[model samples]
Target: MRQGINPSKTDNRIQLESTHRVILSVYIPNLEEEYFKHAEKVFKLCLESVLYTSHDKTRISIIINGCCKEVEQLIYSYKEDYPLIDQVFYTKENLGKINAIYSIVKSNLEPLVTISDSDVLFLKDWQDETYAVFENFPEAGMVSPVPSSKGYLYSTGSTLYYGLFKGKIRFRDVQDPEGMDNFQKSVGSKLYDPIHLQKYLVISNPKNREAVIGCGHFVGTFRKEVFEKSPTKVCEFRVQGGSEEAYLDDPNDRSGFLRLATLGNFAYHMGNTPAPWMWDKLADLKSFEKSNLQTYSIPSAKPLSKLAVLVGKFLWVNLFYRFRRQFFGFLGMKEKY
Candidate 1:
């Protein structure tokens, strides 16, 4: 009982206008508890910051994972208001953060994709600064706007191995100590060592544009091709444990792509509570003029051979990783903080 031609058969293929896609997985079950009292407000701030600062061609996909009806309605309202919010998926069942991300990323066609936590407050120029890192480092697969002093400890084996022999890596004075301190305060923990806050490892190209080696998982922009190497199976954890390391971190490292961060801090990790300062920051963002969006192509990278990756993990990452600080010191990196 179908129509003769369906009219759809002769239609042209659909084309997406965006070059970059931002994916956010939000899970707010309720507002009754003290821990989640201000969750709605914080989510609103996060979404607004992203909308205000992102490039014109960028698209945002919000996955409402097991949130209350109230939260889902709020997200729907935003979608109706903003054209940039291109996709919205709601699930009554709670899917793990990485699992939710994997669902969207598997079908994503954009050259660049940014996976961000729900509470991150993206600042102005975060997208541009992150893209600049990719432009500077052709081998970089992931770039975070918020730099971590202990970034070098994560999945940065490729950065270390390749940059070391090329003499393109060095220890640089930390550019934003106050920003680092703010991150530590947000998490309510002493995450960075005293020495780490002063100096960190950086990789520079011949053009002298430098980026920090390694990055955290809270928020990061990734090249789409790296996902081709990701595991086909969905993650098991509902949230953070080993899920991120297995799905997000390992794929980029195993693919032999460098993980990096901007030299300057362009975002903040606003935990559950929305402080007065966060409100002030959002107010400031409202007044800032939006920049013209420009698009650039990221070059394709070759994945490492299985044997090469295995040997690297065994020899350098597992065995020599602990001694990196001393080794770098021996190679003219000043140990004095």
Candidate 2:
């Protein structure tokens, strides 16, 4: 089913004028067998989440960055397999996250742009929450589930570490024999739990604002107008050599959050990190506002990984993590999404 926009005569709010459309971009680097294998489950998870939750999955577009012949084949496979997606585009350019974002921002078709990373799992109603955040707080530039910076709430005294997925950020304090079980129990009924030990930091303390500044990995929302007027040059600060997408170059600076906070008070970064537990943790969080959201499970016919592939996955992820940290450290850089 297709829907058309009928803007009212007297409405003046910019966002309201541009409602009912959103664009999601999935940027891929080189096309490789490993890329598809490693990402397939989560990619399907993301696709399924939207299919089950959104009334308008047709609005979603997958933009494959830095395409090659192999990437083209991989994308074709996805298109043949998943029709809910409206279009698949492959770009040969090497624009990083920032430039890609600018491109999305420039597009007149999508009023809202969701930069969805390839390696994240989302709840079925993730977009519902995202849309609600923008609608409820018109000033909000971006909204996402809060990312955990440390382990679970059961971990040592309250603390946080930069996190991307649920299991990825193990809270040392919550590592007791049954700590995961305990933390899961405590975060009950909320949309998301804080990092293992830092639940207090995310949900309870009430940061007195709708949004906070930090790099939100899984997904980030942007008000198109923000990009229309965003500074072309990157902010000068502690971090170096990162995409201009970050408004704040200094990891320690909260200025970006403050800027975003002026727009709305409900933005939260979503998903777990520092590990690969995104699906599990997200599964635990309740969709407090999205009443119609539905969860679906596609039974894994079997573990897709072979022993050699499993070992290789372990090594590759480990090396990726270590190198990611060291590379950022060497450059004194951190992403602020």
Candidate 3:
């Protein structure tokens, strides 16, 4: 039976005010193991850091990807406390990382979506710096707050081509060695040689605004339109492997957009274990000031023709890979690797 004179059909729907949305996928199965003993605390810090640093209008979506009931309850409590937490999805079974992320990203209405891991400590001004990169580089499709020393090697053919012809790309002194060192320590891997900490490839615009050439995948902001080119089918990998490259990285490049990062580190990967420095850094972080929210516009990426794509692939495979030293040297890389 239908109710008479229901106002639902005639009523206007509410509009979302946010321009950006942050997506986080958490998969903490249990806390019994030594590896996950401190996972809950670390996750709390990650959430707090984002809430503290993000703009008031920015929305946060948390995908509780088969986490324990305890973790779910904790997240629910956070949702109640923070108004910025826009949505929380819970799954009884574990969906792979990329699958879980795509489920939300596909339907996201915001123009900008930031896909972040469960344990990244977002520093202050991360949004500002990221937006600055997008404002300066109209071709940038993805921007990471944490810069990588060897990031220039990633799917950056378009950036390299533009740099060569425009003479805007060059090697610059690394801005934050301590921040890079912290990232290396967090991952427990030697990601860079000593010389890499001293200098890295950067691209600058006519306005003298500079950004790193490439970015890491742990955390990055993407234009929502780029994901429109991603495959509609679900990813096959359970966790890592080829999932990131297939779903996130390749689409941007194939669409002829540049992948870039901020000149300095504005986020830290806090891995599984909670280090003392993580807490110290969290304590040192300042709250986001409303006055600091600057208005800026991000230009859409110009789609490349089929001929341009074929030419880029040929150059990347033939010239760039075969004569790496000579090619990069021409773009102002001094050292011969």
Most accurate candidate by lDDT: 1
Local error of candidate 3 at residue 28 (angstroms): 0.7
Higher-ranked by lDDT: 1 or 3: 1
Give the TM-score of each candidate. Answer: 0.94, 0.48, 0.93
Report the number of the highest-TM-score candidate. Answer: 1
Give the lDDT of residue 185 in candidate 3.
86
Off by over 4 Å in 2: 1-37, 40-42, 68-70, 77-84, 148-196, 200-217, 232-240, 244-337
The models' CA-based lDDT, in order, is 0.85, 0.39, 0.84
Please write out the lDDT profile of model 1 over residues 1-337, one tens digit for every residue. 7658867679867687898999999999999988889999999999999998887889999999999989999999999999999999989988989889888999999989999999999999898899888887877888999998788777776776656554387788889887888888888998877877888778887777899988999999999988988988877789877888888888998887888999999999998999999999999888878765456666665445565566656656566586775778775766642
The TM-score of predicted model 3 comes to: 0.93
Write one digit per residue (lDDT tens) for candidate 2, span 73-161: 76577667755555666667645555544455556455455556554444444555556544433433445443333212111111112
Model 1 off-target regions past 4 Å? 11-14, 302-311, 331-337
Better of 2 and 3 by lDDT: 3
Q: Which stretches of model 3 miss by more than 4 angstroms?
A: 4-14, 286-291, 303-306
The TM-score, computed over Cα atoms with residue i paired to residue i, of candidate 2 is 0.48
TM-score comparison, 2 vs 3, better candidate:
3
